[model samples]
Target: MRHLALISGADANHTLDALFVNAPLRDYGLRPRTNDYTLPVLGMAYIATYAQRAGFNVGVLDAEALGLGIEETAQIVNGMAPRWAAMNLLAPTYEMSARIADKLNPQIALMVGGHHAKAMPDRILADPRMRHLKALVLGEGELRVAALLEDMQRRRELPGVLWRDPLIGSRAGGVADPQTSGQMLGPDIDTLPYVNRAFLPQDPYRAAPTPADRRLAASRGSDWLTAGAAHGHLEANIVGSRGCPYNCTFCGAAFSANPDVKIRVRSPRNIIGELDSLHDQYGVTAFRFVDDLFLGAKRVIDDQMAAFTQHRIGERYVWDATGRINVLDRCTDQELGTLVANGLREVALGIESGSDRILTAMDKRIDAEMTERVARRLVAHGIGVKGYFILGFPGESQEDLDATVRHIRNLWAIADQHPGDIRASVFEFRPYPGTPVWQTLIKNGYNPDELLAYGDVDLTQDGADESMRQRDEFNFSVGIQFGGVPLDVVRGTLALLTREQHERNHSGQEAAA
Candidate 1:
């Protein structure tokens, strides 16, 4: 059929990057209700649309939204009879993703991309069962993937691609020289097609965020589902920018990790235009901007907010975007107001830690003071704040843990007083190789194989544990303690922080003793 299948493989349902339903979790009486099932195409929509426009046939298989397990998903793709299947891969879900690849019809050639794939291409290709994985696309994959689809019918040299041929030997370009986004070769953000939703299931796009997200949002006057229902519309995830300028050690967005990465933003007109198309064509009124750096700087914030205001985006539709704690810390109350006035219902911050030591270790360049100032200022203006934290970092101390807990409590206190709500999205740290922290662990006699072992370990957890082992950390580290703190303290603190977030976000839960 000369068809290309763009697949978003299964991810741990517990974290923000989850694309698939957690059947294993739900089977054990865990919660993954209707709201959690459907999610917009992460980056596959762009690749699909771009390939389609380039005269290639592309099909989307969202395993998570379909609620199909590993075997069923493989069965369906085999029936589709695709010549090439390209997937976005992550470290934690490597096993699940690899399983899907293994079960695919051997006739279907595979290509992989995403940060994990970019960092660990050799490991993926070395798997004996992944023989079908012929190539790995690095960095922003829209153009690279389109080129791959065009070239896959017959092998030819292309920039930014690493492929292995059944006939020819393995090729270079995986690690050495893949260009990141916003380079001279990168596609213009404004001109790309609106991600062809026609390629994906429409119903999934119609659903709102998970229940916890909705509750926290409502606490801050940012309930997208209710607000969207008022206008007889639905919700979808959108992107305003690509790549990040920051070099936070825990993040792969650093330019050192990817070759020549640059942050790229769509023009205000282009962004507003997409909103209009989504509204009129797809019935989507509420949006969640999933940019790594949506609010780039004051100038960018002004330009986007000004354009959105001109288009009446605030009045007609609502949205939430990623924010920089350091950037917003410097923003004036009026500047924050400008963002709120332009339909920014809430801002998600990579607060990372409440302790300056941990924050400095992260290379986040923002401190607790900056975070508190930004959170307080934003909430005062009625904009929601979603603070994300990492537990058991590589070198965290007891004092650092105490500071983080205190900071989270302070954020909650701020939310309690204002119309804005705060959500502390905490995750146990897992050091992925190639990230700065991974190198630190390596210097400290840590083996990357240890993390790979976690990924390779049995994902099933005992019922005694409230949380599943197959979490986002499964790809990083399930529980090898890197920090000085003991494993018990780490888990206990994880439970404590997450439970508090649960009480605030879910509501109706009695306080824990």
Candidate 2:
């Protein structure tokens, strides 16, 4: 039987391989951690399970988690000697993937896929650097991969597969036409196999620790402490739904490469079955629903919650998920209360900015007041709330920064009333390709080619010669300033506001103790 090996490039050290299906891109405030938490490659696990069912031997390797450098990862792949090998690709990790591919035996059938490949297949293939990539799989890979492997055995070209053009010189060829093959979206997500966690390493994957000021964690006292201590110990990542419906300007998922932009979900029965399997087989009682919008559809949320109650799933496990403030705002108090009753412990809100002007510019639709209302409501229902804030956009000024600071103060006030009910983080806006904002940046003199050539590193850094630490400081310093706001003033204001919030939360924690 032909064996297929699936792998991720070695850790880049500046970023975490969390959010993407096949590649590592920063999403949902998940940056390269100072800690040891690594999210599992859910997409790969699904593909592995599907391949095994199709009579192919499969093996999975996470180079980063194992702390293997690119050369070392390639050596291990060479030892595996699989008939075919595929590696996930991220924009920043593209160079590392290419390096690893070069080190592999040339005869090994090598394929590449993931967010970067799907978004820029033509650019990826046309690059002289990626000449070693045999084929590119776009969008969701499970069904397409099964087809590709079958075609390989039969020695025929397959639809949905982008093969390098043999006639063109590698260095001279222009970008290939993306229409070379018809890429199809996968079948009903509900019919897909549950991720084969057994293929993963036996050691438990760690999660970033919950902040001490996190609302639900603070309110529950001992229970929260226990869960925090066990953060990533028995945690498993699950996706109840696929695709996102909203079109936030900075989101790649919202503008995913998938041809069909519709949202698809697993039935409540399917979700419960997987949860049960995780519980019984793996002793996992903690879950992180990694969906782009777990609560995007109210009916889906209601059905899933009802199923959890029916199966007593919530009684046994505690879970957290990502949601939009607008979506949660629409939920009635009763609905949210029921969710809290059913094990929803914490939620990460993509409250991108606290400034109404910035929020409007980003096309976020929701305003500052609405965000506060929803956040407080969630806390009231006993669900922990983490607010994600982004500073810096095309045109923002001191007033806008001040507005955000005011919002943070409001968040601190909420936390004071309900201690540990709030956790907030700020990130500089990154001009990721495939987003509307990226195009705006390009028009305003930012060069896409130059950025791409720099390969994938942390997005919040300068492309020139500067350490990541230096770049981070620069980003935070200038992230919120424009015409009226002096850079130092903006930085100082943000520093003061953050310090005040920190002191208040510390006081609250001390008092509670």
Candidate 3:
């Protein structure tokens, strides 16, 4: 009998309604069909690789990719009849697992792991919905989970795994003394085995297994998707680095808690080598640098760019990445141009707020002037810049809100001043657990009990609309605000701001005439 089954029930993240949140489900087209395919999450693939390497019989059930509902996934798992079943836990999928656990109780030792499990162990343990879960793997789970399966096979205890006990509160069950593993970035990422994509149905919408599924079910070959034919040029998603140094308030807690571990990178040669294979085998040209801050370290970023320049893949491909505004500001004009020349076509710059006070409150270390300067410079270099802004920070006043509107207006003006240069995005603040702002909000009596309530507030609660309507000069507008800023207000603000920018452009044209 297969001792363990690394069952990843296909996930459907309907709760968040944001595509990136359910990451693997991103490839689904707007019209939701039963047969759309989603990219396999790299993390889950790594976990499956490590588990298989540890010598246990493992099978996968990717319900999300199959577009199977919870009941359908449970039926499949019941059919597989593995001794232990493992599921990944993200904030949005917590309820999904609860529903699955309710249906498949007492048959399998269900285990859950991921960011939500690591950050909120106490809460996860206490939730009655997940009480039936045999164990919850906390912290960096890939290596830890592999160790856990080995111990489970030997009838030894599992370390770092929380189990329910009637006599005492949830106690550590399984093996003792699990080896210490840092959340630091892993080494030689390219060496990890390719993900086993066979378990998921080829046509995710059809709810029918493919020939690949039969091959994976029978365990005929260890490398199921190695031929790279299944995933087109667009299916590849690679991470070259781990960690971010900056402490953006709204950023996820996993990143903020371990800031020093930020910017750890694999060798440029190794990264480039993988890129070449991905390009050759999978026909992948469009790549995304999935790091928190891709250009955090000057030396590493420069080295990677140098490699890109030497190899010159820019002729065929385009790429995008995320970075801090300060990083771009510090970059020389020549370096910025070099980056664009080497295929850095798009950047998501975290200019969290246009107001200096709010920026200081978040410890962002960037000002409006610096943001404008760097954004303009990126545009001049023929690189697209997307400015990220935040609203509804604590200690913000009406004046600060006005400043934000004005700041976005100035950016729109920049775009008009130099057409086809830059674009801007506005977002509201969502205080994640364990951030400095979260703690402050807690201390100041602001309740954050609702995980999905950040974007649901009524923005007019603070008379923000009156302030925005009173603005004398405007350009491009971004209408994201916390406290439930009305969607229409946001639209109107953006329209007003755009109209002002257009008037400015017309004035310039008339002067030329």
Best by lDDT: 1
The top-ranked prediction according to TM-score is: 1
Against the reference, the lDDT scores of all candidates come to 0.66, 0.63, 0.55
What is the TM-score (0 to 1) of candidate 3?
0.70
Task: Give the residue spans of candidate 2 off by over 4 A.
Answer: 1-34, 153-157, 169-184, 202-233, 256-259, 453-513
Candidate 1 root-mean-square deviation in Å? 6.6
Q: For residues 320-388, could you state the per-residue lDDT of candidate 2 as single tens digits?
A: 888878878899988997887677878887887777888987888799999899888887666787777
Number of backbone-clashing residue pairs for each candidate, in the order shown? 2, 5, 12
Look at candidate 1 and tell me the lDDT of residue 303. Answer: 88
lDDT for residue 64 in candidate 2, whole number 0-100? 52
lDDT of 3 by residue, 1-513 (tens): 121133442222211100011222211222222323454555665666566666555555655554456665565566555566677775445556656656664656667777667656677677776666666776445565666566554323444567666568655555554243233123335455544443332311222222222222233232322222123224345666766666766566445654434346767777777667766765655566766646656777788898888887555555667777777788998898788666665677777667887888778888999999987887666566666666555566667767888887787677656523345555444555556666666677765455423222233343444433322112111223444345454445444544444455456446433
Better of 2 and 3 by lDDT: 2
List model 1 lDDT by residue over 1-513, tens digit each. Answer: 221233432221221111121211111112232323444565777777776787665667766555456776666667665667677776665666777778877777777777787788777767766777777776666766666666663224445567664565555553323444334236778888887766556432544343333433354465544554333337667888876777788877775676556567888888888888888886677788878767756777878877887777766676778888877887888877777666677788999899999998999888898888888888888888888889889889999988999999999998888767788877778766568777777788877777655432222222213233223222135568878888667666766676567556546223210
| C-alpha RMSD by candidate, in order | 6.6, 7.2, 11.5
Scored by Cα lDDT, where does model 1 land?
Answer: 0.66
Rank ordering of all candidates by lDDT, starting from the highest: 1, 2, 3
